[model samples]
Target chain A: MSTGDFIFTGLGHAYLKDNWIFRNYRGEAVRGQVLALLGPNGSGKTTLLKILLGALTPSEGSVNIQGQVAFVPQLFQVAFDYTALDMVLMGRAKKVGLFSQPTPADEEAAINALERMGIGHMAYRPFHEMSGGQRQLVIFARALVAEADILILDEPTSALDLKNQNGILEWIDRLARRENLTVIFSTHHPHHAYAVADQALLMLGENDFESGPVGDVLTEKNLLQLYGLPLKRLTFDYEDLNVETLVPVFRNCKRRKAN
Target chain B: MTEKTVKQEKFSACSSGRFRRWLPKTPLARPWILGLILLIAIIGSLFMGAYPIPWHRILEILLNSVWPFSGSESAYLDLREITVVTLIRPPRILVAVLAGIALGMSGTALQGMMRNPLVGPDLVGVTSGAAFGAVLAMWLGFLYTPVILVLSTIGGIAAMLGTMALARVVGGRNDSLPLILAGFFIGAFFLAGVGLLIYLENPFYPKGQRTGNIIYWLLGTFRGAGPVKAWTIAVPTIVGGTVLMGLRWRLNLLSLGDLDASSLGINLNRLRWILITVVSLMVAGQVAVSGVVGWVGLIIPHAARMLVGPDHRRLIPASAMLGGLFVLGLDNFTRTVIWSEVPVGVLSAIFGTPLICFLFWKTKTKGWNE
Candidate 1:
């Protein structure tokens, strides 16, 4: 079963006839790989993500998915005041019987998932009361307990602060590299893609897309074309370590240091 | 983490996973302990009516009615007190308890399914439809039979179907607002029909002749509770409550909205309809047996959430017990404390609307403390 973990080609969707959101999109994800999707707002990144998650079907193409796929939606609020443990335990929905309550074994597994996320101490705490980072990690713990082979995250770290963003990126890397789970996340950050992604897909237009290794695909020229904003590959040394980061060089910034 | 200490945890321990939340967290409010308290409250209520009866005489009356025993306590039992406790109080208390349980359970299931805190069974128009059906049956001269109850159940289901179909015509299946608005209109329509039927039944007569019976029933009092009425409400509540309680965990997921729940490999359509049908059936039973006991279906679930913290496994049972207590307390207030009988449904609306206002103010100002 090694003909690429999954592949989709010529995928396109439109809410109305001839009003295509994105088209001619194709990508392949393998096990132990993190694929990042980059696009501007209204570029149908969410639509493409929905297609990959099998929640929505592409009008023109097909996604051949393999293994159990677990989806971690973007930061959200629950209507009820469910506890953190209760939130994680809902991951067992696929495992628990229709008429049966969750047994001690299931409860133990949920607790372990929370513990693995390092938020076990907040098990009994209300979910809505938790911070955005805590909630995102709780969703990650839910995905882990579901025993998913593929993880689809929709802008997982877009709403978090810088620290939580990096924390989420680290977990995404770890889940793919160590857990051997294929991850595909959609975000607006090109640097996030450069930092963690093996391959990047940029949806430029309805029929235009760029896909390749992160190095070749996330070039300054290509990102500038994709976002209509120039992004430079800046190199700097931090703590005696050679590092590179992408920064958008906005044209509106004041050129002179002092007036 | 917020200092919301659950007063319902000891009772919450009767459950499994979250039930254990009570054992290590809070050390009181066990199920049997609460059950004992409920029993005492119920027995204490029996002695509360205008015609007072002592506890021992009440027990003797119950025993002599059920048990063929040679006891000297029968000598002390008076006919009037025995009639008050056995014939009158038992059925009234039974109806109140069963209706409360039904309303509470239905409210929890509904709130979980709708994923909105403001949702209630009465909001969906099923109660008014059932009320119309009962009134229609009474108008057709089947006032003292089970026909009204049967028609009431059918009417509730029919009204819900109409609400759905109307919503489908307008908003399709995905939007939640159409369904709610459709329920509001359909419920109002049926309530108007109920009013028309009542007026048509006795146009020239004054209020008290035949209209008094219809008007009293419409106000929803337990003044005429009997074995027949109590059993009618009990059958659907027990059956539907069992099905709903079993689905508590699934409801926690279903309430996560359509997208994530579908990702979880659950069939949302089948689950949603099952919940609707069962909730409609239980509400229909309450409305049929005791005319539209208004706010228990709206109020009890929120109160239970404050106590049990929104885990449906604990919330369902806790709301149910609280429901019975709330309605029973209201009935006691009207029957004993007041010189004249006030309707339970009316009393519940008076209490429920204020609670809603308080909740709105609290949630609005605090923002769920996010």
Candidate 2:
């Protein structure tokens, strides 16, 4: 199994018709390896995740995503007012019998996942009313509950406090070391990539990209070229809480202020 | 080996804890209570009607019909007793039960699969489509018993397919909002078409003939329905509903959204189409028999979910039983509560709205999605 390779060759995926959301895109994700898909907003990071999850097939090129993959979508909105526990137990859908309802064992599995994330007390609370950070933790618990070897997450930590960011990062590192689960997640925070991941894939263009060890690939030069800006690395008494800063290249382009 | 296994094991334990929180202990008690209520509702539906039969005789007829020779000679059961038990009561009871269950399961499946609380068979356009189909058949003078049933069934299936196709074209996938919007447009189109058809028939056929026929069909009645009609509707209704029930867990996964559902190896596209078609077909059969009783599709599923929690495994079956009981109980009230027979469709719509609204109002502290 160690020698077994899961690779994508000449994979190009695009969005559906009339939706300018995603254009032709070539990318690759390796098994048993962390590849951080980074780009500006609307760079198709989530689109690529969707293609990998087989939610949408690529318009061009083939993908060789072996084994079952678990996905944690960026936006998680449940239809009903379910408890945090209900959200997590859904992860075991593939494992439970198709007809069989969630048994006592399945419920126990969901609860265990929540407890590991330290949100066990929030298990009974309504999912929609939770704070952003709390929701992120619950979503992570759902992804982990699947027990899938390949995990795909879209923007794993877009909304979280500093403490939760660090706490979740610590848990993720533990997961990679102990579980050997192939984790593929997208995030705007490069620090999260540097802190936990070994490899990074920067989406340089629709068809052009770069992938290598995080430190080597995420150099000052690489950051400048990707964002088209000269980013200043700041150091405080402690480490920078967020990723190393990448100033927008087109700062005076006026889009930054509007956002 | 130990470290990694333990990390995975730690998370596994966390998930187990989540399950404990989500799957409420009260759900186990729900099915039994619902079953008792259903038994009571059925007996009530059987006993209370316009023409009064002694409860003892009704029970005796029910027994003698099945067991035979329970009492011979002066047990003295006449043709009227046989007619009431076999012809009148049995078919009506079965229709009410089957239609209710069908609509209930259909609503639960649609709501769960679509990830929308407001969605059900009517919102999906199955009922309207089926109604149009039945109306078209009747317009063509296919009013004889067997022919009407068959034509109604066909109409229902056709309408269901048409609505689904339109929803897909507009919505891209099995998205709830778009599908619902499409249903609205399609329903409006069909409703107008039916109105036009009725107007056309009025001049061509006898003045009162076309008027009463279309009105009764539109209002969706269980009056004058028989066993043969029950069997026709029951077979497909139960079969399709059973298939939906079998896929209950997958349906729950689907409600979380397509991307999340597929990642769990659900083959989302196939399941989406299969469910859309099956539920449509099931609802079509129910509508063909009972016209287009509205809220049974919308309200019963939610009430059942509220009773048993939203786990489709329990939710679907409970919805079916309770839906049947609900419709039967309502129809019985319509029959005996007043001297004249009321349209069950109107009664369901009028009755269901307040109850659903009240439930929503009481739970207003929580938003639509929890």
Interface DockQ of each model:
0.48, 0.44
- Model 2 chain B, TM? 0.86
Residue B58, model 2, lDDT: 79
> For candidate 1, lDDT tens digit of each residue in B179-212?
7898899999999999888777754455557777
Candidate 2: which stretches are off by over 4 Å? A1-5, A14-32, A96-126, A129-131, A234-259, B1-29, B66-78, B144-154, B157-177, B202-211
Q: Report the Cα lDDT for residue A173, model 1.
A: 92
RMSD to the hidden true structure, all candidates: 4.0, 6.1
B27 in model 2: Cα distance from truth in Å?
A: 8.2
Question: Which ten residues in a row are the worst by lDDT in model 2 chain B?
Answer: B12-21
Q: Global CA lDDT of candidate 2, please?
A: 0.74
**Number of backbone-clashing residue pairs for each candidate, in the order shown:** 2, 24
Q: Candidate 2 residues B41-82, lDDT tens each?
A: 787677778887888877777778788877564257777877
Best by TM-score: 1
